[model samples]
Target: MVGKCPSCGEWNTYVEEIVRKEPSNRRAMGGLETPKAKPLSLSEIEPGEEERIDMHDEELNRVLGGGLVPGSLVLIGGEPGIGKSTLVLQTVLRMPERKILYISGEESARQLKLRADRLGQISNDCLIVCETSLEQIYVHIKNTNPDLVIIDSIQTISTESLESSPGSVAQVRECSAAILRFAKETHTPVLLIGHINKEGSIAGPKVLEHIVDTVLQFEGDQHYMYRILRSIKNRFGSTAELGIYEMRQDGLRQVSNPSELLLNQDHEGMSGVAIASAIEGVRPFLIETQALVSSAVYGNPQRSATGFDIRRMNMLLAVLEKRVGFKLAQKDVFLNIAGG
Candidate 1:
């Protein structure tokens, strides 16, 4: 049995699996043509503005610079049941003009249909296929010639070039590279969904993030209805861009003006409550901050914070005790962000 993993430094994480090698002499399936190469001077190349397709969703478009860039590979990652697929499906379903091909490796066609019905009308001519073999996926892509491509989760796709199982480090890396080459060569925009590990990073090799053109992280507490989409890496847009959405029974609803829902008017005159303004992307909104101070029951004082940095809270407390001459050292302080 393996004791420790040299790659991730995790212990007792190895599992037993059988791998069958495939022949390398088989015909290529990814439709990647070897183009003739030639060297050119910097002045020989022409420059022009990149053409971007409008995503139709304001929040989504803002996070992706202005719109979706052609031939770009975008990867969206989140926890289980965090609405990664739902968000993408809803967005693509709204675009009727674009011929979209959605390839699902984790769910069946009927299962996806059920979710789509709940989401709303399918405006686009979207084709759904359930497949895991990377080679066969290219065959479907060649026949469909879709304007946009969607891969539900890259980890579920396995390439014949590697003998390792799907979701393995080797498989994820190779599959992503193949998809990247296809997107660049075909000038097709691809939206990829990925799962995050327990450590809150994308599962599989770190090279997966580097391979994509853009990386977005969907985060929020499952118990809460609010979800935040943050851009961790963007080759076309600013990384500081953020998108906020509210989960609903039908689907995700965009929050254009979040200040209205975030402020609790009922807590008007309550002590230890205050309102603050914050900006995410280009939208500015107001939020509520609540603080509670009480005498410590035990000899040691307890400091806790939710939706805010605890270390910053401690530093603030120290500032109050020293500069403001407030005796808060022996008291308990609890801070929370409203509607977080």
Candidate 2:
């Protein structure tokens, strides 16, 4: 027998790491029934997956690995104003036929409506809730029984049982855990929107990511009209899937061909422009990488990047010197994603 750990209420904490010394073959215990039933036959088993959650975008569906799988929990995180909520709202809105419930903590129904109106086309079947309490949210969910549920920013939601303030580490972790359990038990696919820290990771305890079946990071610069959704964890599909979108007045439009958007169209054979193939999910993409190596006038060599990694830039520069004999230690290397 197993029990919950009193310290953390986690089940199976006292696992039997080592076998106990029992009397030799003490009549191996069996089930209460006389015999277990036979497994289901192949004919009895059902075929054909349930209808995919259609978002009306071929690229989005492709990145989702043939559409949204039922009972899947997806966590979407992004920087503030990076279009995470807008992208999800657009996705749900584009699916005019699918039953969707949009739970917003950062915005009101009227605000969402205004944005939806700006987007031009939206489904009337999409439900909206602006509450933060998990119990209340569950109550509404039961009443609505939506095919898709969007929680706008998970950190803003709080559970009544949690004494900590909303957005706190405790509350974020607890609310997400409860939602994950509810999603799995009810077989309802949930899309959780989350905020990102200044450090460019999903804000909140790392445990929150582990609780969900998929972790998607929405990234892009505010100045640029482009946004990227990169999967960090995916239990239902490949994690390397990446979805690119171009923010416009009508809504976030999917980039059918990302290479055309990410590469510099007017290169003119730029000295720093370099295109490389990157493997994201099950697909390989050719992305333009621009690196600028300038003499560092400031006392501290400042490193700036648009969509590339700063640490990786430093490492690459070091390699260029150590391997290729290009002494760029005192130079400032600025890297960017080139175009949209």
How many residue pairs of model 1 clash at the backbone?
A: 0
Candidate 1 worst ten-residue window by lDDT: 23-32
Candidate 2 residue 17 Cα shift, in angstroms, is: 29
RMSD of each: 11.1, 10.7
- lDDT per residue as tens, model 1, 1-340: 7899989999989998999887332345466453434899989988887899988898899899989999999999999999999999999998889999999999999999999999876654999999999999998998888999999999999988789999999999999988887788778999999999989999999999999999999988977899989899999999887888999989999988788667787896689998878776677889999999999999999999988999999999999999999999899999998776
- So what's the TM-score on candidate 2? 0.73
For model 2, the stretches where C-alpha displacement exceeds 4 angstroms are: 1-51, 268-278, 282-284, 289-337
Candidate 2 — worst ten consecutive residues by lDDT sum?
25-34
